[model samples]
Target: MVAVLARFLVPLNSLLAAGGARVSAAAESGKARHPLHAMVAKELRLWVATPTYLMNTAVGPALALLAAVSAAVAGPQALASAANVPGVDHDALAGLVSAAFPWVLGLCVAMTPLSASSVSLEGSARWVAQTAPVPSAAIVRSKVAANLLVAVPASLVAGVIASLSLAGGPADAALMVAAPVSCGLLASCLGVLLDARRPRFDWASAYEPVKRSANVAICVGAGVAASFAGGGATLLAGPCAGIAASMAMAALSVLAWKAASRVSLQDR
Candidate 1:
């Protein structure tokens, strides 16, 4: 009986030791990783692995490119004919469309997967995150960063193409660059805030939150309103108005992010 007990105890002790080593290694690695980097990695992995996210990210750029190519192929004659309509200067119309197109595309790109869907996708992970020492604010910021990572470059590409078509000088090019980036930031912050306000973790599909949620419509509406407002401002005030609008949107984004951070994980 004593021999049998010793044999059992020996294997049990070995198993416990191996488990302890693994736990220690994991803890050490966790400590070594920055919270923001880890969160961004996790979010990117989700975005890459998920079909809905891939579709959401790709659709905007694809549409923008297609429209741009079609417009370019149509030549100035088509545009000029349309510009012949009352109150539409061909140059101004071209510039307005050029500036507004990229901004709207960037806004849509940021709005798609980074907002309600992101929060809902976390689902039970929020519980795990809440139990961890990590701050919810950091998590939120990381999501915003991940969205910007995907969005800013796409927006920049579209904006540069549009700016070239406008034939505007350096200042117009600068406005185009700054405006989309600011719009992307605004969309990201708004997304997180909207999700925090009405997180829907019970969805059967990831696409539901991204495509079907009320927040999507709200965000899209806001984007449209902002684009119109910015275009109007640019019409009245010149390219500087675009810069001013970007600045204003960026300020609002910061404030919205701050408010989102304070929201309870229970809400997520």
Candidate 2:
């Protein structure tokens, strides 16, 4: 019986070894083919490892969605009345609705505290990524992917809420989703670009780079300015506004990512 068992054990070991080899090969193949996916996964894992960062990331979008829904229910007049300001007289209601969704979505994504400090978050170990053989484009793309991974889902939620609230038809609902998604994409690109250009390697705490950094202010300010412009375009373009605005944002996102890829990642 011992001799029979030993013979079987050798075959079993050989089978297991073959299976392991296949799995290892597949993993390496995947890594080689989709490096960006692996990098994005790493970025996401970093967020998860840091409970505070993860909580803030999830909470920001939730609050923004809550605010958006509240604003929708309250209506423009009630909002202005709450602040003792006159009702929104100039902006059309439909346009206001269109603008409000993207406004919140952009603000939420831009305020996520991920992209603006993505590189800086590396701290003293920042040299590892900067010194690696990976292309800068790949680095920026992974950061953008991780950012969109957080923001795009929230944008969809906001879009669905917009559609259920006031959208007239399928086209309207699509525009609602598309416009906010585009805003998220653009915000991610812009935030990454700003941080890549000016990474603050000197910081005592995470807050220094994540919240108090100049990039944070610039990102938030850009999001606000975009909301105003997007709101105006939605007001003026009537039915096609969302489509046009999204296209323009998409273009700008491409430009921003290109610029970011060119940035030199080194000390300071």
Candidate 3:
């Protein structure tokens, strides 16, 4: 038993030592940069290197845009028949499209798991981060910001594409943009909070956090619920419903970020 333990412990210790040295060297070199900027850059590099993260971020918006464009090509008659909105008139179909598009875009933005992955990635580097002189709040904020940076832009592009393809007016276009951007921010913040609530540090693969984590299911459920809520709000409140939902989501995001910062600090 002693021999077996030594065999494993010897190499494990060596690897940890090497990793620590590398982390320390990098920290020294980056001392001149703000910790938040450095952390954000690190998270961004990790995301770019991971193909699965890239795919998850891109697929949602791409599919939403494709569906919007296809619906536009199908015309009002097809949309009315599909939606069962009780009228085949241009106005009814246009209203339905305008109302539905924001929900779809918002849901797509919410499906992004970049924030969850950022938290998980930090698990491997928590020791390094703790040893550095950076505050826990900066670390948490950087992770959330990195995910938002990617998710928000992707959602906005999808919103713009959908609005243009569907022939929505300037107001509709603006609402569409705001809905997705706000949803992405909300999703990212919520993801961080959820992960902080139930963090898993023991993982063999990067995919484990985003793909197999319980947080994934929670985030997906939240996205679906928010999408339904947005649709319901639009039905009851008209085209400006998305703006209202965005406002509520923005407030929720601020709260979630505060919670995440607190949770991350405790974990540290």
Candidate 4:
């Protein structure tokens, strides 16, 4: 995994040191948000150029969604034939989707060779982004944007699959769809914040930081706990649960980003 990711990981390190990371002083007064636009564009370009970077997140979720659909298709018939078999009832679907929510979303953002490792991925070359003539906030926001670009669409698809499988009332169905999206928000924020706060610059392989690093574990752990709480609420109170969970995630995400925004990449 590290070798594959290292092949295309941020080939822009040189450009970052050159001029791509540069921003005009008047950019803040302009509509473009200057350096932020440049930084985000650079990250987006990397993904477009190295589509393989996304495979880790994409492959797993695709498989999970396929399994959920297959279960939904064969669930009723199998239950009719073998009463002792595992159930795929609405409640079962709800719990399954809820529990799986953050794990799936974490694939896109928190469990990273990307966002969670964006800073550390720079390795000894961290000076590129740090020396750029832009606020560290611009760099931070760019990472967040890059993460969301993948997470939003991917989470929506997963949620829709869960929603179809659940086949519940409007609120429950909506909750199924909303669950992954909110979890992604929380995961992304925590991933970025934790990585920024404690980065691993010296690594023999990118895989080491991703698996051996504390950021990924903490971020994923928090996501699972928060998501389980939300899922438990759904089990206890159907209607208000999803809304409350989504709102709580959104609020915490903002706070996390706020903390992350204050981090100085140059120092890390």
Identify the leading candidate in terms of TM-score.
Answer: 3
Worst 10 residues of 1 by lDDT: 1-10
Q: Taking the tens digit of each residue's C-alpha lDDT, what string does model 1 give over 58-119?
A: 56545544544554565444655665767877766665565555455445444453654677
Considering lDDT, which of the candidate structures 2 and 3 is the better prediction for this target?
3
Model 1 sits at a Cα RMSD from the real structure of: 12.7
TM-score to true structure, per model: 0.77, 0.75, 0.78, 0.72
Best by lDDT: 3
The TM-score between candidate 1 and the true structure equals 0.77
Tens digits of per-residue lDDT for model 2, 159-198: 7775665556676667667766777777789988999988
Report, for every candidate in turn, its global Cα lDDT versus the true structure: 0.67, 0.70, 0.72, 0.63
Q: What lDDT is obtained when candidate 4 is compared to the true structure?
A: 0.63
Model 3 ranges with Cα > 4 A deviation = 1-32, 65-91, 165-170, 265-268
Report per-prediction Cα RMSD to one decimal: 12.7, 11.6, 9.2, 6.3
lDDT of 4 by residue, 122-190 (tens): 678788887898877778889888777766776677556655655446775566556666777777787
| lDDT score for residue 30 of model 4 | 65
Model 1 stretches with alpha carbons more than 4 Å out: 1-31, 65-113, 266-268
